[model samples]
Target: GEREQVDFRTSHRRKDGTSYPVEVHLQYLQGENRRVFLAIVLDLTERVATERELQEAQRTLSTLLTNLPGMVYRCQNDQNWTMEFVSPSCQNLTGFSHEQFVETRQISYGETVMLQEDRQRVWQNVQEALKNRQPFQLSYRIRTAEGAVKWVWEQGCGIFSATGEVVRIEGYVVDITQQRALEDQLRKTERLAELGTLASGMAHEIGTPMNVILGRAELLMRKAPDERTRRGLETIVTQVERITKIMNQLLSFARKRPAERQGVNLEVVMLDVLDVLQERLGKQQIEVVKTVSPQLPKVWADPDHMNQVFLNLILNACQAMSDGGTLSLALHPIDDTVELIVQDSGSGIPEEQLSKIFDPFFSTKAVGEGTGLGLTVVHGILQEHQGAIRVTSVPGQGATFIVSLPIYSEEVRHEA
Candidate 1:
């Protein structure tokens, strides 16, 4: 059978023996004298090349978005900020799959991930930025699907139509939790350095007077014949001695000596400190519990500094338990570092006071009973040795302090 018209696509060969794609069309034309067929060929080389280039660009874009360190999202300007498209990094950034974010199956980015207190602030900020047609940057905390809190930094702008109407919001979000922590630590270190300078100056100014008062009080006690007068002199001597002790602590805070670093056996140092406190522990009826891991590695630290560190901590534990309690101590290796855990079963610190415990002149003891520099000095010493200490406690339960120091290594020698 003959068809009125025929159309098909095929490859055409040139005289150079090179082939390119072509679209072919055939039409039949009949005349009274003769019958003839007409054919037309269209070259598709440019069209085919352009299609391939477009596909490659799309692939490149997809790869770049997938490997970004943070999530890339385009969402509606609605209350939930309902996502229209989200990058695969959503799992790592928000702990949710991209599919879930796109579908919003059971979670909404604004409602579920963002903190309740921050929801309104974020909404208002975005709206303000959109109103002005400008990009906005935000730093806020979000609770992840795992129930862990994290800090995030986001920068975004609105998608506007040709008529200048807002259509969508697109942004990138990255984790800043670690960066925020480092900044906070830097601030604390700066504050302590300033306070230490002030304390040192005051200590020097008061040191001579304090010593003179102690000497006068002792001389007066020796000269007094009446029992009441002698008792009064004794009280003066004791009070002067206490002030002297505080002055020495202030000087220590001001003049933190560089550590004489060496490989130290921390267990031996801890045991020696405990032995020195044994009598005090006995008097207070405080039971001691010790757990030391066998074959523990040595730590790169100063032996004397380690001794002072243990002494201050253990003595503090003893003071907390006036009615007698348990003092649990443990030592073990954690990865490349050694950890010492000190826990006390005494009148534990209040929750609100935990953060301030390491601050200078911050203490839980009654007036005239403490100088409040014990933990502050300990914190300074640990920082010098490239170590860290953290405390956990519940009011009336107990307090546990965890200290970590780097394990002895050849690199530590050069670094120290």
Candidate 2:
């Protein structure tokens, strides 16, 4: 008999009654007067155990990648950053499934999520890092699937071949938008604190001279002989008063007076402020629309500061609409906070200028029309009260300002 060789894997029992993995091979041969079969058994116990260990390691790696807080990615060094592998966390980070990046290839990470303006910088940094044989870390902005922009931090290194050419890159990316915002807020707070110290010194030096000039102008106005002379003195008085007003504003900004916190009804405060501006609103032909939640809880705030806050906001709204537009005010309780919204149908702020609006001495008003510290003071007041203010605007349409303050509570009052 003559037969082809055969090989198969199985287990065999040992003399000690234990089984071990083995690979068996068989071959048949024909002798002149007899048929003979030859068999070979190869021990595979160590090999099988090694394979099981490798499988377990792969499973552990898979679990780690799946539960990672950020995205783990391996991509080629191409313009589109074509991803070869992406962890399941890709969906959590970029709002795109891993298959979209790796399998379908429908979305390229660089072309899809990364901002166009940042791509060049990211590429440059990564190349420089690779050249130096070092890891790269980058902080850049990305637009998410929901059209929201987020700040992300990535740390990775190039996977280089033996010939020193980068074949691919692997990295982990996590969202850092909140961290970036906190950093910006911190910088602004530091700047404001420094300005406050400087303002305090300048106000003291300028206040005395300003008051003297104002008093002198008033005295001279009383002694003017003719209409023209009287008019000249009047102008001096007006100019001096304006300087005094600016100095007063600087002092107010510099002051760090403790808040006289109380349970203040914002609806009542709004009414009072509106009443004060009634004549001016009428003169400008601006309409008022007010909405207040019927059972709104009082806010924990300083009454005087609240009055000032409302006054400044309403006046700003009034000033924004020179031709008389609608001023809409809304107040409601949101969770543990009370929210106030003041909207104006007027000349809105330019997108670029919105960030600078709260900066001291930055204003949109014409010369001599505004002291430029109104919004700064308002911002400071809100920060002191542990509240927040945010604004949104479209150039030709209108602007909306939202203010949120903590709701009044007996514990908060006692702590205050």
Per-residue lDDT tens digits for candidate 1, residues 113-217, read: 988888899899999999999999998889888998899999999999999999999999999999998898788888877877887888867888888888888
User: What is the per-residue lDDT of model 2 for residues 1-416, given as tens digits with 9 covering 90 to 100?
Assistant: 56768999998999999999999999888877988789999999889999999999999999999998888889999878899999998888888898888999988889999999999999899888999999999999888878888999999999989999999999999999889988988987888788778879988688888888888878888887888988998888888888887777677667777888889999999999999999999999999999999989999999999998999899889889989999999999999999999999998999989988998889898988888888888998998999999999999899999999999999878877
Worst 10 residues of 2 by lDDT: 247-256
Off by over 4 Å in 1: 1-9, 24-40, 161-165, 213-250, 293-298, 319-322, 332-337, 347-372, 392-397, 406-416
For residue 89, model 1's alpha carbon misses the true position, in angstroms, by 1.2
TM-score of model 2 (CA atoms): 0.87
> Distance from true position, residue 157, model 2, in Å?
3.2
Model 1: worst 10 consecutive residues (lDDT sum): 248-257
